[model samples]
Target: MRTAWLAERRSRSPAAHKTMDKIVTLLAKELRIQPRQAQVTLELLDGGNTVPFIARYRKERTGSLDEEQIRQVEARAQYLRNLEKRRAEILQSVAGQGKLTPGLEQQLQQATKMQELEDLYLPYRPKKQTKARLARQKGLEPLAGCIVLQQDTKETPAALGAAFVDPGKDVPDAAAAWQGALWIVAEDIADEASLRALARKTLWDGARLTAELMTDERAGKDFLLYKEY
Candidate 1:
């Protein structure tokens, strides 16, 4: 039976095997159990055994793991499976866009959390018909790049934008070019995942919540206790 299970596991795709190993290792470390314990529990769970049934009847197989431990393993295994699914989808999406480099693919594969994967993929994600798209349509991306590079050029941003002023492209004047460039720059800034993550952390760690009473009489009566405290 063990040999058959091992053969079946070997027949699975390499990625599936990798995900299984990762889940087993992570579960063992997090639950402070032996790897054999986590592995057998996962096998039992995968075989459609109920947590209660396993805890009640499969003590020998599970190394005597309790219901709570088995439940935690089940829940964590589900979450890890879902996370792996999302990771594969993101990798395929980025590859489809022709933007998946080795470094990026490695980062995506190594990301242990959903937020990390999302943050890394933010800049490559498709956007709506946004200001950046409109600006790119007007051929202002180069100007945006120049602004970002901040190279040693005698020409100011407005002066550089003046060269891109083409009425045919709807950029009638330097001002229009500058505006489009600024929009592109703003979109790039918004898409910067690290900056967004830093901002989120700062606000979450330092920001305070305040509650205000409504001016309505019913609101005052409903939140009477909050009015003073």
Candidate 2:
């Protein structure tokens, strides 16, 4: 039984390898340990060993990591496993919709965090009746694609937008069509994983917080220290 399990594990798919590599990297960075230690500890955990048992009896396997460290590893490993499971479900969902492209599949395969995977899948996920969906319903997707491509810089937006005016679709004029196209473009930008990640990193690296009292009446209360900016 153990031999077959080992053989099956050795034949893990590429997606599993990617997930494991990300988990190992995260564990090493978060625990301040080597990747080999993280990998060994994860393997032991996956082999049905309890944290206490592994920390006490399997010290040599985990480089003498204590119970606390083993617990942390177990928690992080479970979270990563959940993340990978979500990724697989998302991939299967997207593929079932017949909308999964190579680029999208690659992004899904490489996503280490749930947030990143969800961000990448946002555009593909089923959403309520949003402005972007309404705009697409009006047959403005081709115009939106043109705006994204930005190939015809010589043509003004109004001039390009004039071509998509279909009264039957409720697109009355160039301005309304342009506005709908802008909605699609905005949603596309918001759904871009790389851009969202960069924006989040920038905000965290440079953001500052300021607090102030709501009014003078509350100034003399227990929040006196927060009265001024």
Model 2 scores worst on lDDT over the 10 consecutive residues at: 211-220
The CA lDDT of each predicted structure is 0.88, 0.88
Which residues of candidate 1, in runs, are more than 4 Å off? 1-11, 225-229
Best by TM-score: 1
**Per-residue C-alpha lDDT of model 1 across residues 1-229, encoded as one tens digit per residue:** 5566667877899879888898899999988999899999998877667899999999998999999999999999898888899999999999999999998999998988888888888888887898778989989999988879888998886789899999998999989998898899998887776787898899999998777676875857878667634
Tell me each candidate's TM-score.
Answer: 0.88, 0.74
lDDT of 1 at 55: 99
* Model 2: colliding residue pairs: none
Candidate 2: how large is its RMSD? 4.4
